[model samples]
Target: MKHYYGVKVANKIARVMVSSPERSGGQNQYIETPTIEKPSDERSAKLVDLILENITDTYTLESVAEYCMMSVRSFSRNFKSSNAISFNAWLINVRLNYSLELLESTSLTVSEISERAGFHSEQIYRKHFIKKYDIPPKAWQKIFKSPNHN
Candidate 1:
């Protein structure tokens, strides 16, 4: 039923969507961002938006650092200080959460959802999913998608 990225659900959930135009496919990346009381500062807030905006692209710390007009060390320190999470970890969480929503809400194939969630491949996505949730995505989807789930 959601036509676009950044769909908000009831109970205060929201998504922040950013398009990655540099990539050829240029899929929108979404972060199921929770409400934030405040950011550390203006620059930090700006950086978070920038990073989340480009979430689906292949970005190295050095590349993101240069793109942001910052040195690698500065970007790392500032990003860590503000978000309290490393960029890679946050990105993975975002992609996984997005994939979960897709699984529960759509009839998309596992591979399709995995790629849409910006994973390199289904195998890699499965690995991460199993590691994080202790179950494969398909099984998780089955349980949640079933009518009897409670």
Candidate 2:
């Protein structure tokens, strides 16, 4: 019965080929998992470009709605419907992208980069950066900007 169940399970799943017969000897390679990115509609895509163009500018949900010439409630509803992310989340994503560029291209400290990228504080920026990138900003800078990197 044990051997029957093992055969049933083995036939039901994909197998990895390894040179060694030992089960533990198979090398595990890092594979990038697929991400389901939301496909923004035309209006939301344009708004993303506009927000990035003025990335350094301070923004509030109310102000963004006003800029879009829509009522705050309607703006929130429509933006989320089209973009599949809340306004605040998308805003943070934009800020993170700007900070990444700064980290790679400039010698600025993390605090300065956070402030220039419109994050509320360095700690918060690092928290979000780690959550999004699975690494700290300085470490990312070291890996990406180092001349000694192979």
Candidate 3:
């Protein structure tokens, strides 16, 4: 005999199965595994670290290449090859991620967070945030903020 059961908790369902006689080779075949890629090399890893450290600063491809002690052309080529994304895209992602953390952790307004995130203007920050998250930063903050407010 076999039995299957499902329980709902916190608006999500948890499923379980039980059998009088256990079957061999009954693995979770439906589970999905994610593939995580490592940094291609030391240079790419260092670049990522530096960017994260100075995520609030403005940067250009040429300036960043100079800081890395490489020619602009070589830096752009290797950055894309090693990171699997363009430099600008990586920088924007880093800034956005930092902004998200600030929004969730602090009570700062959206405009203040935008300035601290290295965006040139709040409008630009709002546009990018909406594009990436499909919701405004204010709304996102409301959803993620703690529930202890009066």
Model 1 lDDT, full chain set: 0.65
Per-structure clash totals for the candidates: 0, 0, 0
lDDT of each: 0.65, 0.66, 0.66
TM-score of each: 0.66, 0.64, 0.69
Model 2 spans with C-alpha error above 4 angstroms: 1-47, 146-150
**Model 3, span 1-150: residue lDDT tens:** 332111111112212332222123643211111112446666666766777677677899988888778999999998888767788987776677678767766789999999998998999999988876677989877765534322
If both were scored by TM-score, which would come out higher, candidate 1 or candidate 2?
Answer: 1
Candidate 2: tens digits of C-alpha lDDT, residues 53-134: 7777777888888777788899899888866678988888768767866776678899999999888789999999888778
Point out the worst 10-residue segment of candidate 3 by lDDT: 4-13
- In model 3, residue pairs whose N, Cα or C atoms come closer than 3 Å (at least 3 residues apart or on different chains), thus clashing, are none
Candidate 3 TM-score, C-alpha based: 0.69
Looking at candidate 1, what is the lDDT of residue 32?
Answer: 35
RMSD of 3: 11.4
The C-alpha stretches of model 1 lying farther than 4 A from their native spots are 1-44, 50-54, 146-150
